[model samples]
Every structure is written in structure tokens, then in C-alpha cells.
Target: MGISKKTIRLYASAKAVITQYLYLPGSHRLNNVIKRIDKLGNSEVESGIEKVMRAFAGRHRNIEQTFLNHFSRIADQNKSSLEYFSLQKKILLGAFFTKEYSIEAAALFNPSIVPHPDQQGLKADEQRFIMSLRATGEGHISSIVFQTGIIDNMANITLDNSTGYFTPLKKRLDTSYNKLFISKRAATIPEFNRSILDNLPESFSAAEASHILNSIKPTEPSIIDSVMVFEKIMDNNYELESSSHVPLNEKVIFPISNAESMGMEDARFVKFHDGEQYCYYGTYTAYNGKHIQTHLIETTNFDVFKIRALYGAAVADKGMALFPEKVNGKYAMISRQGGEKINIMFSENLYFWKDFQILMEPRYPWEFLQVGNCGSPIKTTKGWLLLTHGVGAMRTYVISAILLDLHDPTRIVGRLDKPLIEADENEREGYVPNVVYTCGFMLHGNHLIIPYAVSDSATAFATIGLDEILRDMKL
Candidate 1:
């Protein structure tokens, strides 16, 4: 009735040494600060710049250049011209507006594992893996960070040391939006007018949409509310990318859009093959401090990412996981739209889905509360193995497993009546008590590598024999 428990290894959490500097608005009266900088003497400006360079040169790359970039952004806000200020003075002024942020100050958990694309110089039994984690910083905001390592022949885990530097992704301003999708969403708003969207192209940028909205002269006060809604929708659908020089582990996918202003939670990453090429795709929940929405993140090299909003009636709730490949010539996904039962959905298009069917429900006492998929299903020789989470008494969360027919995934073949892994004494004492969760897992050799969160605070790893778990399944 119970599976054997194995050893679990704890990883380092929230290293203060790794930090990213952000450009912040210094004071309420920014114009006065700029004016004061313009009056500084030549020697004073040179001395200030020298001091800042000496203090922060070791902490970041090209400190002076970063300061200049910040200064240029701040100068754009000033009413007066920055032509009078010297280069040194501008750089010095930029230092005052820059602030250091610790990316993982709060916690690091909810890990997802995928095989590294570049797998060279590895032993016969060793496979390289890229691990993505949820790094919570100040203000309880969550960002996606990564780590790289290998699983040896003996099933021992070895993680590479991080460079102690984190780079946030830059928003790609040229990202376009679909006019049809926008029109459909706009119809739900009471004050939105269909005529205002007439002349727009099939695809357009945020700026284009804003210009169209501004040109309309509505006779009612509710038009202001409609304008606000239009702006928010544009903000939710944007793109972000990181520099090529930044390593995979050093890149941080922080929330840039208003829809995810609060946090980007529990990304379920799967390395998918679409017949011609392979790409990495992740489904995550975006929280805007008030409401939650579903988002899809795409990346091939892990250096750059394209994030977009997922639209559909079935994508209304959290815990959405996509299969690694299409089933019956259509893309398939697992979701819990009702928040209690597991549902399967298929779509010809990746972004929009409208069809769904009930897959499973709470039958066992331990899962009477609710159930959801843990990550994307792992295809095996037996069937499509799906890892799931079930909530029970005291609001405790536990991981379980189920098997589905290979060709017809909608047909359930077998299930595990008992929990595979549960929180132990040491794991049940963090931010949320009695919770052990994971976004995904990987299979290496004969072992299943599970990187799981401990009470929603930190991350750890555990390995289970693949054969043992398969033999223990109840058909």
C-alpha cells in the first residue's frame, strides 16, 4: 500500500550575495534632483563618479556603462534639457537613482527539471539537466530562476555553483497583439464600443491600439473605464528577452506585465517536439494582486523567451499542464478549471482552447477535498504516466500518480491509491505547513528525479526507482 521512501538532498536557498541592481525613481520631486546635479562643479562630479565606480565595480559588469544607461532613462523624464551636464555628471547622477535588489531574499522553491540542450562531454550514465525554480524576493514577488547540474550513474546529484549575478529580462517593445482576440475580450466590457476597433489591422502593437482608443470621442463617462481596460489587456500580452552573454542560471524572468504584478507562480515546463523542431514550453499562473490568469512561456535556447496570455473558457483556473507531444494530431493539455476535478482539453491552436472533458474526480478519502496534475505527463512504455497532487484533511497536499491509455489518453488505465511522496517532519515546517509540491519531474536511467518544494519555502531532490513505482501501481 505504500512506496519506499528514499534519501532527499537539501539545496542552498536565498543567497544574499547574488543581487541585481534596478533603476528606481529617487524622490517624489525628481526635477529638483536633476537641477541640483546640473550645478555640480567639474572636480566634484569626477570625484563622485570615481567613488561609485570603486565601490560597485566588483559587484557588477560594466558598472559605469549601466550607470549611463540609467541616467539616460532618468533624463528623459526631465522637463529641461540635459545638454548642459557633462558625461561624468550624468553618470554620477545615475548612481543616486539606482538600487540593489536581492533576487532570492525570501525563498526558492517549486522546481521544474528538463534536459539540457547542449549535452556534450558527459559519461554514459550521466545526463545534464536544467532546473527552473521560483525565487521569491522582497515584497513577496516571485521570479523564475534556473540552475544546471548532472545526475551520475549512481543516481547522485551534483549542482553547479551559481555566478552570484542575476539579470532580469528586457521587455521586447515590438511585440504584436491579435485584433480578433482583443475584440473578443473587449466585448465583455460594458463601455467598450465596436466602432472604435474598426480601422485597426488584424495584428497591431500596444502603441497602435492606444492611438486608436485615444482618437475616439465617447460621449459617456464610462469610456474612461473602457480605455483603462484596453490598456490593461495590452499590458498583459508582452514579450521579454535576456542578453546572450547571460548564462541560463543567471537569468531571472521577473514579472513585467500588470497581469503578473504580484507574482508568476508554479511554471510547468515540458520539452516538446512539434514534428520538425523541439522547443521548451511552460504553462504558469499569473497573479495581478487581485485576479489570476493563465500564461504560456516559450523558449528554445533559454536565453530569450516569448510570454503571451492564454485565452479560453477552460483556461480560467490554475494548475494547467501541457503534454510533451500532440495526441491524435492535436495539442493536449490537463487543467483543473473547476478547482476540484481534473479535466483534459485539446486544441488545434496552442493559444486558444474551448473544448474540455472531465478526466478524474475525488473518490479516495485522502483526495476528497481536491485534485490536480503535478506536471506534464511523462510518456513511458506502459502508458502516459501523470503525476498528480491531492488535497485532504487539514489542507495537506500530497503527490500521487495515475496511468492513461497511450493512444487514447482520455481513457484512464490505472492509478495509485496511496501517496507517492509526502512532507516529513523537517519538510512540514516552512512558509506553508504540511505542503510538498513540484512543477515537474524527469526520468534519468532507471530513476525518476523529482525536485520538490519543502513547505513552500525551499527546494530539495529525491529519487525513486522507476521499476518499483510501476510495479506498485493498482490497475
Candidate 2:
């Protein structure tokens, strides 16, 4: 297969990056590194370039960073480095480069030679990568490009409309491309084990569905700290589970906290465990009640705890809010002013109540004069566990956890000497950082399921062992 001028440019662009590392004088260590790039396998300068570029950063930082700056650049004012070209360049940068700074280092030089024959960025075949995304819904943004040459020039593009790249001339069929990268397309999709896409509204357009498909993926714009997370839902409610443990009462009713917004959105009961069902607590911003949680479904006999609501409720005159979780027939809680603590209270029976009316109080260590920030709680084998997120003067909230006695809830079984988990650059730099909040958790066999809202736009999940966390909770 003969390479077109455009492909040749992309190929050369990739090759130039390698020569600068091997042939260009630098720390002989950097030069020595390129030989390994050469020795890895047989190559026509072109294919060799791809192999070297892919492996360059994997082995070391110095060379990869040199090319990355261009990859990360939103605009190509410099127009002089291997990173300077199409989305494919950035794709390679993300796959090969390690530390973000490594890619940043590559930005130093403007790449002159095109990787292809005509020195263009992406070849047409590469452009097809974006086209495969099928839209199932709406409100999406995508990036696309078009080959609007003198109509006579048979030049190709790395990205395109039919193949899912960005273009300047708007065709009636092409979706709007901001190139600010607000749009999306599916990069990887497993062969269907049988995909069931329900709740598809008829009002949405094909372009809109494609845009949404892009959003629910591990895309470059959505990558956090260079790590991409593919969530089941790009943006939706937190996971709700009916307690796995069967409750004493078979008819436990969850009061609809946010009934108006949820009921209209197709809220219904989906059984998780044989007898476990999740209550979809929803909210309505159109009305003055956004914090309202409504019971969308009910499970006959189960054990589930509403974590955030445990703390959001204002105590009579405590001057601080407390959050509580009922675990193993015991209560685990944390307060805004108090650290990790719990107090099992005795309560009166309701029409079909299942929990003990245990009084829960703030269980903080005596070390801090001020109360600790409030956090979420979950049950663990070690004890009744809690993840507290307290606020500092900057209004910054951090995520942390500690454990309590499984039997007698008041006992301060263990406290995290320090916060076990906190915000990273991703959570800290977006709409809001220093804040990691979990509405609830799913105790799946051994792993603790934690789903958190990111900077408030999207949602993600993290898994940690129940026992490993207990190991860290030192008194």
C-alpha cells in the first residue's frame, strides 16, 4: 500500500521526533535510548517511527515530554512539533507518555517535517476512528474535520466528518465541531454481549446521540490526571441499593424526598439482590427543593443506609450538622464539627420500622478542639465505618475515613491517624476541588463501592477493600 502525501507527512512528523532524540546531541543517555528504539524491531523509517514514538516515553521521560507539549496544545500557534498535528497525535501522546510534564517537554520544538508525503496531520483512514461512535441520546459535543481542498486535490485528513473528525465547512449532515473538544465519539466498544439501550427519547437527533456516546467514554478531554474512567452512566444519580441483609419488616417505605422531578423521569424499582431494591431518591431544581430525596422504589426486606442525609439534617441546636449511617443493626456517623463517631440510639416503632432507635452522637478524638468536617459512612467487617469530608477555612472539603466498634457502636474502635483518601489534581482544579463527596456506597462482596461527583459535572467510582481499609484505621 502506497502512503499518500498526507500520511507521509504524519509519518515524517513522527520520525523527526525520534531523530531529534537519537541523532540530535543530548545526554548520551537520551541518544543511547533511541538505539533501543531502532533495535526493538525491523522498520521502514515510517513504521519504525510509529514504534519508537509509541515506546519513547514508556521507557523514559525526557523524549516523550518533548513531543507532548504540542499534543496538549489546544491551538497550534507554534505549528512546529510532532505534537502539532491532529487528534491522532494527542492520542499517541496519551497512550505513550507517562507524567503529563513528559508530554509538556516535547512542546519545546516546532516539528517541521510532515509524517506523511504531503506533511499533513491525519490520513483519511485515521479519520474514520471517530466515525464508529453510534449516538443513543442527546446534548453532546464532538470534534470533526473535512477535506475541503480545491475539490480536485485528492489530499486526505487524519480526522473527518464521515469518519468523525472536525471540519470548517458545515455540511447539513455534519455535527458542529468546537474543537475546543467539548464533543465526543466512542473510541472503544466491546462486541455486544447484548447491549440494551432503553429510555431513548424520540425527540433527539442522530448527531445528538453521537455526542452523548462520546461523553460516556474514556476520552482525552474527560481524562482525570491522565487516567480515564468509563462509568456506566456519564452523569446520573448515585448508586442506590436495598440493604443486602434482610430487614425485620417486609414493608419498609422510603418517603419520597424529591418526588416531583423523579416520578416523571421513569423512576421504578430494579431489584439488585434477590430481595434487595433501590429507592431512587431524586431532586428538582425547578422547584425550590433540590436537596429533597424521594423514595422511588422499595425492597421488602433489606439493609440500606442513606449516607449524606445522615449529616445534612440540622441537629436541634448543635451548631454543627451530623451525618449517620445504620450499619449491621448499628449506627455509624460523622459531624461537620466532630470527627468520626457513632452512638446507637433506641427508637419507637413506626408502622413497619426495622432499625433500633439508637441515639447517634459525634465520635471525635479529643485532640482537635474544633469539630472535624462531616463525611460519608459505610459498613465494614472491622467495624461500623465512616468516610468524613470536613471543611477548612478556604471552604475546602477533603475525604477521610475511620472505624468504630461493630458491636457497641459508641466505642471508638479505631480512627484514621490521617485521612485515608483525599482530592487529587483532578478534583482540586475543576469547578471545585478539595472536595470529594459520596452520596452512598455499595458493599459488593469484598470491595467497597464509592461513587463521587467530579467538580460537580460528571460522576466516577473507586473501589477499595473493606479489610485493607480496616488495617489502616489505627486508634
Candidate 3:
């Protein structure tokens, strides 16, 4: 288990914190806030806006436009037309409705790494990467955030500084909905009437779905309840786009759906290579406080993301990681259903996983409490290199490795007898103590770079020679 002290260096400056702010409406008092703003004198409105812009305008892009947009949203919610208002009044009123939220004020942890889409300026041995972390704020609500960095030939890591402005994704309303998919999903609910969706075409737009739902007669309370669920289903599976002009590090994938309103936790992103096409897919757990579901996020250039719910029986539970590529002509995934043992599943459809088989169980003391894959399985010359997290005494979390037969990944090849990374004294205190975990890892020029979270409070990087890990793994 010996690894050279010179080989591993923790990048302390790589820690991620909340530098971005989101605009949210004032809770419960929105109606009152609007009424009070309407009563403000013209001179008072102008002076208030002037002071507010001087204090906050420099921190964001298009501050005036954001305010106007917020005002428009408030107007729409109150079912009012866009009445003519002085520009100064709009700015002042928008400030009243808006509040700043520090998105990652509480904790930032459980990061996953993937090769960046663009690597134009790098040297022959250098690789650019995008690391996604779960950022939790005031309510312990988590969202996905990014950091871009580069690893040179010498395995030295340098992360890019944040752009100092947070740009949230603009949800696209034009995204289409699938009728058959909704019908199948809704069938699981006993109150849902399949015939209600039978009239819609195979593929329809959101507006069309709304029309159909409104046209239905809600003669019974059960029917009304079922209609609400159907509308929520459509809303849950939608698309979002980032401003192309914004830096990748400043863009965030926040919780946008009721299914993920509680948080989007631990996204394991992988660049899947299928034939000549390369698409990035991240599987994350979507929690709505009362229920948890598996969701898939797909992006090709990182500018736009398409999110949808994963289906079938095996889709239950959290920490589901998709393989980088197909295995034996079928998509593969690593899942932990009951949170006790590691399991593997294969399916032809990326969204539907109907079955799973026990892949690995805790065989050593470090992981005797439970075991789960850290992220996606990494393809390597030796085999499919998989990183795992094992929970032991005191609920202590440690990172370990498992090697699977490349062609037949269900077959075990080698596994590390000891954890590759564990919390030392310096890393043992934070929001959660005695824990070291990651959502993914990447291989760069024979060096396996693992971006992990320390005590579920901050992030740090650890690198080790690929050969050193492969040599010590027990077959």
C-alpha cells in the first residue's frame, strides 16, 4: 500500500466557495412589497434606484435588464399587464422584489471531474478538465457548479479563477414532451387515467399538453390530482441553456424542477464515446424533500443541457453512475439500491434500467458498513478502473479502487486492499467530519487525478501514478 510521498500533493487553493449570487423574490410578502413600491413618490423611487445600482450593479451583467425581468415576472404572477412605468421606478420596484442568495454559503463538496470540451491551447501532454461539485447553501439545498483547470505533463494542477459573476441557466420553454413516455410513467400512479393522454399525439409541445389538461373536466378530486401530477411530469423533464458569452466556470446548473427543488446531489459526469460521437452525461440524485429519483443530464458542448427522469425498476436509490461507453453493446451503470452493496446494470435504452446484478460487496473492514462507486468507471489499459467509497466505523468514508474486466465489466479483475485517499487530521473537521469522497476521477498522462471533498465542506485534488495503484490492487 506504499505510495511515494512525493507523488501525492493536495492543492489547498483549489477549495471552492460561494462567490456568486442569485436573485430571488421576497417570500410571502410579494403582494405587499408590490403595493408599497407602487405607493412610493417619484423622487423617492429615483433616489432609491440610484443608491441600489451603485451598490449592486457592478457585481452582475445587465443589472437593469435583470431588474426589469424580475419586475415582469412579478407582474405576470399577479395577472397584470405590463403597465407603463418610469425606468427608475421599475429598477426600484425590482430591488424590492429581489433578494440575493449565496448559493454555496453552507458547503461545497462531492466533486466529479471530466475532460473539458475545448483543449485548444494545451501542450501535447496537457489536458483541460471541468470539475462539477455539489454546492449547498442556507437550506442545505445543493446545486451543481463548475471549475475549469489543466494538468500538465508533470501532473501539476492549476485551476482557473472564477469570473466573479454567477449566470443562471435560462430554462427553455420550447422543449417538447413525449406522450408515450408520460403515459407509461403516469400509469404507475393508480389515480392517473391513461385515456386522458391518449388523445395527444406521440410528440407534443408543452403548450399542447397544457391545452389538453385544461380541456379535461375535473369532475372528481382524484382526476384533478392526477392532472396536476401529469403537468409536473412535463415540467420535470425540460431543457436549460447557458449564455454562450459566459465563462464555463461561472455557469451553474441549479435546481429548476419540483423533483429536484430540494437539491441536485452528487452529479457523476462522463464523456461517453459512442462510435464517432461524444456526448457528456451526468447522473444525479434529485430530491424533492419527500421523495428521491434518479435523473440524467446530457450535454454535448456544455452550453445546453437536456434533463429527464430515468425509468424502470433499477432506477431507484441514489449514487447512480453511468459508464463512459457501452459494454458488450449495452449501456452500463453502477448503482447502490439499498445503500449496502454495489450493483451493476445494463440496458439498451439509456433512460430505462430494468434489472441489476450484485457486482461487489464489502469484503474488507474499511468498507464493511457499506460500499458504492465513487463515480463513473474509468477505461484503462489494465481494465475498467472504478473508484469506490467505503463507509466503516464512525461512518468514516474512504476512497478505494476496483478493476473490472474491460470487455466483460461484470467480472471482477482486481481491487485495492487499502483506500487510495482517506481523511487525515487536517481534513477531519468540517460540515461532516472524517470523510473523503468524490463523484468522478480522470486519467491524464498516466496520472489519475481525483478531485475529492474534505469533510463535506471543501474540495481538494489528489494525484497518484496510475501504475502505482494498479500494481498494489489484489486480484
- Against the hidden true structure, what lDDT does model 3 obtain? 0.84
The residue pairs found clashing in candidate 1 are: none
Tens digit of per-residue lDDT, candidate 3, span 1-475: 5432223222322223322223345544666776777788998888898898898777777778878887777777674553766777777777766666667778888999999999998888999999998888767788888888888998788888777777667788877778777987776567886666766778888888889878987777877787798888887788996557878887878888999998999999999999999999999999989999999999998888999888788888999999999999999999999889999999998987889999999998999999999999988888999999999999999999999999998888999998899998888998889999999999998888888898988788888889989998899
Worst 10 residues of 3 by lDDT: 5-14
Supply candidate 3's per-residue lDDT for 177: 72
Task: Give the per-residue Cα lDDT of candidate 3 at 384.
Answer: 93
After superposition, candidate 1 runs with Cα above 4 Å error: 1-28, 176-194, 201-204, 219-230
Candidate numbers sorted by TM-score from highest down? 3, 1, 2
Q: What is the TM-score of candidate 3?
A: 0.92
Off by more than 4 A, model 3: 1-31, 79-82, 187-192, 219-226
For 1-475, candidate 2 gives per-residue lDDT tens digits of: 1111121111101111111111224445433433333343333434644776675544433444445543353123223343323444443333333322111111111010001112245333221111011010111211111111111112222222222111111112322232111112112223211121222233343355445545544434434211211222121112224434421111112112232222111111111221243232211111112322212222222233221111112221111211232334432233222233222332221111123222333333321323332223444667767554444445555445667676665566776665444556755644354554443443444555444444433333455666777777777
The most accurate candidate by lDDT is 3
Which candidate wins on TM-score?
Answer: 3
Q: Residue 308 of candidate 1: its Cα lDDT?
A: 74
